[model samples]
Target: EYGRDNGIRLSAVWLTHDPEYPENLPAAPLVRYGWTPRGELAVVYDRSGKQVRSFTYDDKYRGRMVAHRHTGRPEIRYRYDSDGRVTEQLNPAGLSYTYQYEKDRITIT
Candidate 1:
């Protein structure tokens, strides 16, 4: 992450809650409701810590998400380029969305 408000680096050392003992992580959560072991569920400020992104957790660590909370739920997926840029999104119904980059921003077209 980059800086918070007041142009300070996001590197300020802090304490985080541990479900276990002794192992510590970053405190000062970015979420409002709460956070869990998987990480915060609210909003994510990327490495730049400027633009925010919405995120949710999947039970699996890799591969595709087999099931989700939404029904009629498309099998949403991301196709990444060699550089890891998300190049496409495809749905189960065969509908697709192409992605392109504009400056530092990513948008689905």
Candidate 2:
């Protein structure tokens, strides 16, 4: 919906096999979506076409995303507290910065 609302066109292609794990056997039609004026997003599916994993956009412009992970939970690169303020963020180098918010001030640790 973000893409459609923001006028970003989305196109998809089907692949006969998993590009990341070519040796592991699975049925066909791995759907990959290309965001025009941006980049591509791919989804992995089981033999029944049920979504096994989906690439999630990290921002409104869809310019960045969490890297694809075949196993385990995706890492939390950005975190928000109950009030919706960002509590933590991890950079590409895997370093994490903590955020502290108060009624009138914000602090980073």
Candidate 3:
């Protein structure tokens, strides 16, 4: 199913556990999508409506993904350059990868 707000689309989608499951249980009990007002994916829930994962976006960067947190895990973050290219990614383990761009090649360090 979907909800539209002015021009946004695809608010939610139901998935099946098994295509050949019985008619009464063709689809999974519950799986939901939560969308931001700007049409960005915000969170996902399981059958009990518990958040499975959540996402955060950078409003200043044309909706570029800035961070994402999963249940029981530390949030991962990203940084972008002025050109909107990803410059750094920091993971839960505190390891960070930095990206450098050249005229024809990209390097990670």
Overall lDDT per candidate, in order of appearance: 0.47, 0.54, 0.79
Pairing residues by index, what is the TM-score of model 2?
Answer: 0.33
**Candidate 3 local Cα displacement, residue 51, angstroms:** 0.6
Residue pairs with clashing backbones, model 3: none
lDDT of 1 by residue, 1-109 (tens): 3224344323232345567766665455442222334443433333334434333444544322222223235546666665556687777777778888878888887
lDDT of 3 by residue, 49-98 (tens): 78899999988665799999999998999999888999999996877899
Least well predicted 10-residue stretch by lDDT in candidate 3: 21-30
- Deviation in angstroms for 21 in model 1? 45
Strongest candidate by lDDT: 3
lDDT of 1 at 94: 76
Candidate 1 vs candidate 2, TM-score winner: 2
| Candidate 2 residue lDDT tens string, 1-109 | 1113245544333444666888774444344343433554555555455655655455653545534444355544666676666787765556678999889999998
| Per-model TM-score versus the true fold | 0.32, 0.33, 0.75
